[model samples]
Target: MNKVSLLSSSVRQQSLQAVALLVFLVMGLSGAMGPTLIPAIRVVFGLGLSSAMTVQWIPLVVSGLSSLILAQLLHRFGAKAMVLGGLGLMTVGCLQVRLAILAPFGLDARYGLMLLALAVIALGTSVIQVAANLLVVQLGHARTASARLTLAQSFNSLGVLVGVSLGTTFALGAKTTTAPTMALGIGQAFGWSGAINAAVLAAAAMVAAGAWGVSRTSQAGQAPIRAALGSGWALAGAGGIALYVGAEGSIGSILIPFLHQKSVLNLTLEQAGHYLGWFYWGGALAGRLAGTWLLHRGAPAKWLGMAALGAVIASALAALGSGPVAGYAALTIGLFNAIMFPVIFSITVERSAAPSAAVSGLLSTAIAGGAILSALVGWTGEHFGFAVCFLVPMLAYGLIALFAGFGALLPSVDKAPQDSRMTSSVGNLSERT
Candidate 1:
C-alpha cells in the first residue's frame, strides 16, 4: 500500500483523518458543555439572562483569543503533540470546573473560577479544531473538502446530542439556585465529562504515537498568520465564520426560553431541554449527513447560498409565527446551519492564496462573534422578547448568503490535495462510515 508521509512516518492518510475525527467527537462530547449547561448555570447561580449568557460568552472569547495564537503554537510544536496536549488540557479544565462547581467557596468566587476553568477548555478545543480541520483538509481531494469536513462535523453533532441529553437529565426540574442536590448533579456532570475526555486523551496518544514524526512539521503544515493575512478572501471568509457562529449561538443560548413561550411550544424548561437536544441539534446532524451528498455532487457555492437563504427564511418565520409553525421554524435553523461552517471554511481555503493553518486560524478567531453577537441577541431578547430576537440571526443569515455570492466569484487557490490518492478517497470513506 502507498503511504503519505505525515511528518516523517509512512502511514495511511486515513489514520490521520481518523485521529482528527475521534478528537472532534470527544471535543463535542465534553468540551462543548457551556451552551448545553446554560439552564443549569442559571438555575444554580440565580442569574438573569445577561449574566447567564456569560457561561457561553466567556468560552467564546477565550477560544477566539487562543485561535489567534494556535497557528504559531502549531508551528512551534507540531500537530501530533498539539493533538495530545489539546485533549489533555480539555480533561484538566473539565475536572477543574467540576471542582469549582462542588467547592464550598462563596458564590461570586466559585462563579469566577468556573468562568476561568471554561476558558481553559476553550483554549484546548481551539487547538483540536485547528489540528483536526488541517488534517482532514490536507489529506483529501480538493473538490470534496467541504463534504469531507461536513461528514466529520456530523460526528461532532452526534456527540453534542448525547452531551445535551445528559445535561438535560441532570438539570431537569431544579427550582432553587442554592440547592446542594442541584449543584452536585451539575458538578457530577462535569466529572463524568472529564472522565470521558481523559479516556479520549489516552486513545489520542496511542493513535498519535504512530506519527511522532510530526516533530518536524512540513512547511505546508505550518500555515503562517502573515500568509493568511495577505488574502482578502480569507479575511472575508473569516467574517462569515464569525457571523455564522454568532448567529448559531444566539438561537442556542436562548432556546430554553424561546421554546417555553406560549407563542411557540409552551413547553416547560425540562421539555424544552429535551426538544432542544433532539430537534435543534439533531436537525443539524441530519442535515449534515444528507448534505454530504448534496455538497459532494452539487456545487459548494450554490449549496452555501441555499443553506444561508434557508436560515434567513426560518429565522424570519420563527420570529413572526406562533405555535408549531414558530417552533419548527426555529428547529429548522439547525438544519440550515449544517453546511454553513464546513462549506464556508472549504471555500475560503480553496480561494485564498494562504496555507490552511493561516486561513483556518483567522476563520476560527472569528468565532469570537459568538460572544459579541450572542450578547447582542441576549440584550434584544431581554427587551424585545426571544421570538423577536430571531431577527438578529435573520440578518446574520442574510449577510452570509451575500458572502457566499461574493466567494463564488473568486478563483480557487492554495488548494491542498496531499496525494493523488490510491483509490477513491474522502467520498468513499464517508460512505463506509
Candidate 2:
C-alpha cells in the first residue's frame, strides 16, 4: 500500500478502535446498572441475599460462556455480526426487565423473568466485549495495541461511573421515605434504576447499529480458536487478564458496603457511595494515565510487577481495617488494576504465534473469573467477614505479581517453528525481532 492508502487504512482502523470503546461503555453501563438496582429489585420482588447475588452471578456465567462461544461466531459470521448481535441480545434483555414492571403477574414470577433478562444482557455484553477487545488489538497499529485497549477501557470505567451515579440517584428518588431511611433500606431505592438502564441500553444499541458498517470493514482473517487456545503465552496472558479483572471487580463491587459497615466516620449509604465513587473514578483515571506513561518509559513488565505489589499492599491494608482508611486502600487498587489487562494483553498479543482472534477469545473467556472470584468473596463474607473475604483477591493479586516477574521465562505457544516468515497480522505489521 502507498503512503496515502496506509494513512487511510490507519484512520479506518482507529475508527474501529473508537467503536470498540463505545461497546465497552454500553456494556459497562448495562453490567453495572443491574448490580445497582439489586437492592430495590430484591425489596420489590421479595428476594433474599443469596438470591440477589445469584442474579449477579448469572451475568458472569453468561458473559464468560458467550466469550468462549463467540470466537466461532466471529470467525464464522464476522465481528460486525457479533457486535450487532450482542447489542440485540442486550436490548432484548433490558426490554424484558422493563416489561416486568408493567406486568400484572405475581412478584415471584416477575422477579424470575427479571433474573432471566439480566442473564441475557450479560451474555450479550460478553459477546460485545470479546469481539471489541479482539478487534481493537487486531486492527490497530501493533506497537500501539496497549494504548488502544487502555483508551477503550477508560471508557468502560466511565460507563461504570455513569451507571453507579444514575442508578443510585434514581433509586433514592423513587422512594417516599426520608433520604436516610431510603438509603438504609437500600432495596427500596433501586426500583427505577432498572428502567433507567433499559433506556441506556436502547440508546447504545442504536449507536452500535449505525456504526456497524465501519466496524465490519476492520475484520480480518485469523487462525483457528483451538490452535490459539493451545498457545502457552496466549493462555498465560488470558489468565493474567482474568485475575486482574476479577480482583478489580470484586474489590470495587464491595467498597461501598465495606465503608458503610464501619463506625469511624459512620457514613450513610449515600455518603459511602460518594466516597466509593471517588475511589473508582480516581483509580481508573489515574491508572490509565500512568499506564500510558509507563508504556513510554520501557520495561512494561517491571511496571506490572510494581502495580501487583501495590495490590498486595492495598489488600493487606484493606483487610486489616474496616473504616475510611480501609475503604481508601480498597478503592485505590483500581489504580493497580487499571494498567494490568492492557499491559498483559499487549504482551500476549505481541507474543502470540496464533491468530489475533484466538488470543482475544482466550482473554475474553478469562473474564469469567470475575463471576467466580466475586462469588468466592461473597461466600467468604458470609462465613467469615468482608475483610477476610478479600483474601481471595489478595491471592489473585499475588499470582499477577508472579506473572509480571516471570512471564518472559515462560515459552511461547505457537506450534509454528521459528522462522523469518512468521508475521503478525494485526497492528502496524512490523517484523518481530
User: Top TM-score: which candidate number?
Assistant: 1
Query: Cα RMSD (Å) per model?
Result: 4.0, 4.9
In candidate 1, what are the lDDT values of residues 154-246, reduced to their tens digit? 888887777777777776546643457667767777787888889888877876665332444243345668888887988889889989988
Query: Which stretches of model 2 miss by more than 4 angstroms?
Result: 1-14, 46-48, 172-223, 408-433
TM-scores of the candidates in the order shown: 0.91, 0.82
In Å, residue 351's CA in model 2 sits off its true spot by: 2.4
Off by over 4 Å in 1: 1-12, 173-178, 212-217, 220-222, 414-433
- Candidate 1, residue 133: CA error in Å? 0.9
True lDDT of residue 364, candidate 2: 78
Residue pairs in candidate 2 whose N, alpha carbon or C atoms collide under 3 angstroms: 39-187, 40-187, 142-427, 142-428, 171-189, 232-413
Query: Per the 3 Å backbone cut-off, how many clashing residue pairs does candidate 2 have?
Result: 6
Tell me model 2's lDDT, rounded to 2 decimals. Answer: 0.65
